[model samples]
Target chain A: MITPITETDLLLFYYQEADEVTTSIIREHLPENTDWQYFLNELATISSESSSLMCSPSNTTLSIILEESRSQLEHTL
Target chain B: MNAPIIADGVLIQRYMQGNQAAFETLLNRHRNRIFTSIYLLVNDRYLAEDIFQETFIKIINNIQAGKYNHEDKFLPWAMRIARNLSIDTIRSRKRMPVVVDSEGRDVFDCLGISVQSREDEQINQDEISALKHWIRELPEEQREVLILRNYAELSFKEIAVLTNTNINTCIGRMHYAILNLRKKMQKNTVRVK
Candidate 1:
């Protein structure tokens, strides 16, 4: 009997980090239609929200100051 | 910031030569990944920003001090700094319960996030929000591995090296985390039914 594909197995597959043996096993055990892919799809879909947090310091300001401050910080060397 | 595209090796060389624009280019490229990695863990915008800034500052200090050996990609090195700072903040706060201000309002909510992404605009809004929320609710060990893997895009091997654990342990933590999110989704579906 095929061992069940654990969520960790799916996670590794979703990240494309799973080995061939694990991938083949999961693929073998993958439910006919919507089971595994649904969770993985939902995960990949919302991964972008992590970046949605407000851009405090604003990207422009951060870009300028990060380098400008680095230039000045070089003076301390 | 208008600097041309250059490899990280080239950029580091330029920065070492005191060409600041190269530094800006490097920061611009990886800032979001680094910022998001830290923010997802901290769940506190202000603290995350502080960690982000400190991460960059530490990189610059190490670079200038002749210490930063770019054995791996520049982003991972910078991310390591961000992760350490964020975890340090968490450790310090672990002893004291999160306290509300005298007004009994969440003082943290004052520093709201600003640049939310529209990449997943096509997805179901409520489902995506719930999934994201559940991921945040995961235990720290599991959540850190997920954030490092998914958001930061670190390999299990890289995560093991960074977190100083065995690769199997990292994978195990990720397993439990995804399982936790899946169960939460199932529970939500059941409630709806």
Candidate 2:
């Protein structure tokens, strides 16, 4: 049986430090029914979808914060 | 009017010179990454917004007061503020019983992730939510490393500096985090099946 990929191996793969052969082996052996697949999928890209998981504060809220924060900064400085 | 593309340092310099547009550009550029990092840490929407505002307020005031450094490295500086504020909020909230279950899609630790388009994402919502649940359940150190690496997109070296720890320690924490998460997810899978 192929050895299960360790945490270190997964991290190496995540960071693109793993050689192609190792990652390919991992991809082949890693079960599709695990959260590992989910995480790898989620983190595989640097897109806004991955970021939405991190909680994207709305643009309206951000705009208000920016405006109010500038006012506070102006008053303080 | 089209805003001239400027370096982060130039943006800061212009903002310091009372150019509101420059400051807006800078804030717009970095808000999502920085705010998302803060939210993942605190796990509260209003609190995250408060800390985000306070962080930018600090940044703007500091620059105006001539106390800001790290020119052109705006995100890290903003991120440091967000991190500090988040830590303070968490520390102060010691005993707040409620934990956010991956966007409150569930009442408790169980969360449902809605599948959405994200640069060719392939994971289903259930798996993604399970991953989120496991992530939030990880120890704070490990979770912080995960958020920095995954959400903030920070390099390990940058994380080490921000967390004020060694690289090996940070890496080790991330390894343990992922391992522990995998272990839990497997258990969850078995329970469901």
Best by TM-score: 1
TM-score of chain B of each: 0.77, 0.73
Residue ranges of candidate 1 with Cα displaced over 4 Å: A1-7, A21-39, A42-64, A67-77, B1-5, B95-128, B189-193
Per-residue lDDT of model 1, residues B30-115, tens digit only: 77777778877886555676778778878877877768786777767777888888888988867655446788855544433221
Per-prediction DockQ comes to: 0.25, 0.21
lDDT of 1 at B72: 76
Clashing pairs in 2: none
Q: What is the interface RMSD of each candidate, in Å?
A: 4.8, 4.9
Identify the runs in model 2 with alpha carbons over 4 angstroms from their true place. A1-13, A16-52, A69-77, B1-5, B95-128, B189-193
Question: Each prediction's Cα RMSD?
Answer: 6.9, 9.7
What tens-digit string does per-residue lDDT give for candidate 2 at B1-193?
Answer: 9967788888888777667788888888777778878876876656777888888878877887788785437777778888999998888767556656556643443433321222114334223445555666889999998888877777777788999999778889987876676577567654211
